[model samples]
Target: MPAFSVMGEFEVIQRYFANSGRARKDTLIGVGDDGAVLQLREGYDLVVTTDTMVAGTHFFPDVDPRALGHKLVAVNISDLAAMGAEPAWLSLAMTLPKVEDPWLAAFADAFSETADYYDCQLVGGDTTRGPMTFTVVAKGQVPHGKMLTRRGAKVGDFIYVTGTLGDAGLGLRLCQGQVEVSKKHSAHILQRFHYPTARLAIGQALRTVASSAMDLSDGLYSDIQHLMHRSAVGASLDIERLPLSQALKDSCDRSTALALALSGGEDYELLFTVPESKKSMLDVLLSPYGVPVTCIGRITGAAGKLELRAGNEPFAYEHRGFEHFEK
Candidate 1:
């Protein structure tokens, strides 16, 4: 029998999830209460994002619990970052087959570590018995009228993405045994996939400069369509200008690497657009964040279309990217 199998739900929660290290002073009532009582900052707009990970669909049955914990918090924080918000609180709901003390302890510790890194408090949550699945509801705040969105792009805006793309896609391939990589490159690739950084500082910095913005949870080819649709614009992506990491380049053919950059999901990097006038100062604006921002495309007058180009030559690309459901 498992060590924690004899413990009841409340006991498990009290021992593992309650009184987390990330507790905030503004949280009037936290984990022990029926609901959380949090004081929202005055003169600020509240932002919220939620994400769920199921064992079979999102990860392998034997994936590391600690990495899973950090990824959960980071991905939701990435959403808040895309909206130019500062993370404030989190609520976790878990469905588990059983409570294994070692696994639960590692998972909760890492979860609290990431939440605390963002200065967010775990205010309240629920636990239940079922197939393993984790859901996080993250709350944040942004200055009034300063939250970024996907609705502000215009024709002539320059499209940019932070950090490198496709590394996580390549990492997924490594995990699935679909590719072979040098030992030195494998760790970097896997880290990119399992522990993505939320570009909060860069996103906050862009609130004043970007015409429109969002984080790339889905592949660029799929997620950029949201920005185009909301802003009623099209885009021309320069294939040769896509940002790719050295690990990604070394792992696959050029075409394959670029394809992954376009089609892979969970990079958790910010994608935003700048007007022509602001392009001159883009580097100066984002330099403090230490994330390389690449201009690989431009919003175009051709509404609703994504045009791919290799320099001046128009190129065709596979029209599919990662999507939850397909007909």
Candidate 2:
């Protein structure tokens, strides 16, 4: 049997989360207070985002505590990155079945490490006994009038995405025993699922160049559709131009790989549009960042029309992206 903590909520917070090391200079009041106080930078706009990860819904119950902690913070930061903002501070609200010291220690360590890596400080949070879930509220900053959004794509803009897609969805399948891959390729795909790297640098680089942008959390098909809806434009994606990783290509057949790339979620890559005139500069500007940016489509004048074409022929795909309430 696992040992449970007898400490009260305040003691738990003090023991695990109230460390001064997690506090940033901008944080006037961190953990243990009723609320956190932070000083925002001058001439910058604040971007706040929150994401929840629930046991069974968002992750397996037996998942590593460290990876879960990392993901809990990462997904929230990805939203800030989508807006070309620099992550500044975060608050966590965690609901655990019970308090186990060793488990809490591992989770807190990993969580702090990830926050520190992004230069984000933990300001305030709450802990409670309930189903296992985590809600992270993250705040970031962008220069005044330069925050990216999903409402600026134009008819002649070029659509591009950073990094390859579908590996995480494949990784999920491998974890669930629905598919199999060679031992050599399993680790790469699995890591892609469990440890997604937010495209922060790419987002920061495209602040001035991208007309509209969003992080790919709900797969390219659904996410780009959202961007189109927001921008009031249409698009035509070339099926052959979609990027795929070697592990994905080798693990599945061409059609299956393409399907995953189209509708697979949780890749956490950035999808943005640049004006046709700036196309030449896009690659050159992002080349120094070392993240692959591939132009997959073009915005069109036909509003609400999104088509996937394969060399001038219209292609059909039945599966849409993940929906929270699908029957």
Candidate 3:
């Protein structure tokens, strides 16, 4: 028997899985040990990403476990999605206070669904006793010559983004009860927050064509600026051209909607750059993917600056997006 409801998965692992001396080819040694060893392959370039979701930090304490699982896994996949890598496997390390069968079932189901959708496998994990925290380490692979990166962007490349933005931010506002949303539009915003789709296919396809690429985990304003800064170039984005969701517009005015789309974070879409010459053909290739790819702006010669055009003057805002430490 255990106290305070349950012993938790961590306790089970600490008792059994840890230092059990399980030695597979993939793991030279695991558990009940000082450290774990990894077997690195030579032909395929390994893509690695890790993300942590904490209670009340990344997610609400009262969210659905299935959706929580989906979000946790999707965010990790989104990192590989940015690199145009094919997801292969994942390892989960989770901490929780008790064992909730319903929650675990739903979470596992959602996790399996996402992994299967990407043809990835969940190979290993560890559990612990504590406040709820979920960490996923996702592994992906890219060919020897084909991997997209942020450093390949050029001054004359056309900037593009897949799908709409700001819905997730709006969704967060709704979840926090910070914004008033009508019954008619509540579902859309809620879905955006609960289930953000990772644009993996688009990223893989663009790996060969896109000069530079990244996922818009943050706001477009901040993410685009990051690419500009890294590539040693500047950008001129058309404020009018940003894809504003109707869900946002129905809740707030146009200006507010534009600001959210521009600066609101966690859209999980891809922001990439392609040469001007490939623009037309790329558009045709992207159309069949059923996700809208919009050319919102162009890169410029000036480095480390971002200029937005809203009418004749520069589009100004105090801050453009979310920073992990900023309040």
Encode model 3's per-residue lDDT on 1-327: one tens digit a residue. 232236544454454333322223554544334444555456669899999988877888888987898888888888899899977777778788776767776777777676767766565676766899989998788887788888888888998888888888888887776788888889988888788888999999897689999998778988887788788999888888888777787899887788778877889999999998787779677767899888888899989888888756788766645533223
Give the C-alpha lDDT of model 3. 0.78
- TM-scores for candidates 1 onward, in order: 0.95, 0.95, 0.86
Model 2: worst 10 consecutive residues (lDDT sum):
1-10
> In candidate 1, what are the lDDT values of residues 1-327, reduced to their tens digit?
123355765677789877764768888988876798888889998899999998877877788999998999999999999999989999998889988889999999998899889898888777877898989999999999999999999999999999999998888777887789899899999999999989988988888899999999879999999999999999999989999999999989998898889987889999999999989888998888778999999999899999999999998888566432212
Candidate 3 runs further than 4 Å off: 1-43, 320-327
lDDT by residue (tens digit), candidate 2, 1-327: 122245566677778876513457777878766798888889998899999888888888888989988887888888898999999898888788888889888888888888888889888777777899999999999999999999999998999999999998898778778789999899999999988888898898898799999998878988888999999999999989999999999999999898889887888999999998888888788989898999999999888999899879898878766542222
Model 2 deviation from the true structure expressed as Cα RMSD, one decimal place = 3.1
RMSD of each: 3.1, 3.1, 4.7
Q: Residue 96 deviation, candidate 3, in Å?
A: 1.5
Candidate number achieving the greatest lDDT relative to the actual structure: 1
User: Hey, what RMSD does candidate 1 come out at?
Assistant: 3.1
Worst 10 residues of 3 by lDDT: 15-24
**In model 1, which regions exceed 4 Å deviation?**
1-7, 322-327
Candidate 2 local lDDT, residue 204: 89
